[model samples]
Target: LTFNIGERPTFRRFSTPLNQKNLTPFSRHRDDTLNDEIQSIRSLLDRASSGGDRDRASALDRAEKKLRAAQGTRKSYKMETRLVPDPRQKQMFENKLKRLSEQLSQCANDMKALRGNQQRGELFVGARGDQTNVRGEMSGDEAGNMMINEMNDIQDKTKSSIMNTKNMVSASKQVGEATMEELLRQREQIRNIDDEVMRVDDNLNRADKLIQKLWQADGHGQVHTVLRVRQHAAARGRHHLHRDDEE
Candidate 1:
């Protein structure tokens, strides 16, 4: 912004280099925007996947595409907002995070149940495999026909079980991915809020601290919930798996 006679004019706006501290609060708007986009995309995807309509499935695919785009945006925003020292926002961003996290946690549990069902189907196939093997050793004509029939039946059931597993895995992965996205956003939001609190009021001791603590605690609880569900599903699947082996 300095102009001297017989000298080139220089723009001070571009003269000074941008630093981390200066860019911190400016990047938060993008974070908020991306967080909203992710929530909407997830909701749409959820609704699209529901109902008995094949059309809904296609819509769900579209929603997934949007969610991916939003995630890309969020990634860039996170990189831009790294360890921002000061945040100008309040504690208002927590509610959206809490809702998204809880909803995704429920979705995770549902996926766990689906996984259990898939395992049960696998056990069914395993049992059939044993039965077919035993019948194949028989030399009698009746046993031969029975073994052939059992083999065909096993093939059909095995295909069904495999398909079920694929579908369940797909669903679980979709939900798991969405959950991770929301969790990351929530953590960033919390970090920014905490940083803001420390910068603005170093000596503050208030009920808001408890509130933030609860929010963090709830996030941990959601993770634990997902882990517990997976553990339970694995244990039940193992039980059924062992029972099939014994029989």
Candidate 2:
């Protein structure tokens, strides 16, 4: 049962060794032993379940180990040449081993499930006993006082949280009002700037029209345009001075 890569397939037939010649009879005996072990394990599981033995799980572990050993033996038997003439008989042995392994596995699973249930049952009983002990140790008045204290603590915490939330809301409202006032101030300033810009634009437009008229004028008309420009500038200065005085 050895192979080498990148080479032609060559198989060697090995004759049965003298000591191993009794493989067929030995395998048959092992099959019977495995069958009996399977039954024994089933009985052990039943007794353990009924009696609730503490060592039952460990016993199942040992049984599984033995089962694995038996399976290994069966594998070795399969590898070795057998004296049995019929292929069907060999297949029957293999099938029997398979069934036995499956039964053993089922028993192990049942034991695990039983152990889990037992542990859960013990925990449930322990919890109940602890509860009973605690109830017995404490007086009704004491228990009631403890509950009252816990309630008072919760109420105090709740009131404190409410107060903190109210303070936060008041602070947020003040912040919002201040922010709105500042925004209103900035809006008023922007409006004043726009009005000032519009007035300057109007003045620039009047000056541009006067310059165009002066450019198209004869000598006397040019002199008249200069006079009108000076009069306009003087009027604007007086208007600014009167506005400052009124302010």
Top candidate on lDDT is 2
Q: Write the per-residue lDDT of candidate 1 for residues 1-247, one digit (tens) a residue.
A: 7998999998866544567555545455655766676567657655544532343445455655665666566556555555454453222233333444455445445434444533443444445555544322232343446557778988999999999999999999999999999999888866765565564343234334544565577876665665555566556655654554454
Query: Residues 95-122, candidate 2, lDDT per residue (tens digit)?
Result: 7767776876787688677666555444
The 10-residue segment of model 2 with minimum total lDDT is 132-141
Q: lDDT for each of the candidates?
A: 0.56, 0.65
Clashes of each: 1, 0
Evaluated at residue 195, the lDDT of candidate 1 is 66
Q: Where does candidate 1 have its weakest 10-residue lDDT segment?
A: 134-143
* lDDT agreement of model 2 with the native: 0.65
Tell me the TM-score of each prediction against the true structure. Answer: 0.31, 0.39
Stretches > 4 Å off in candidate 1 = 1-25, 83-247
Clashes of 1: 1
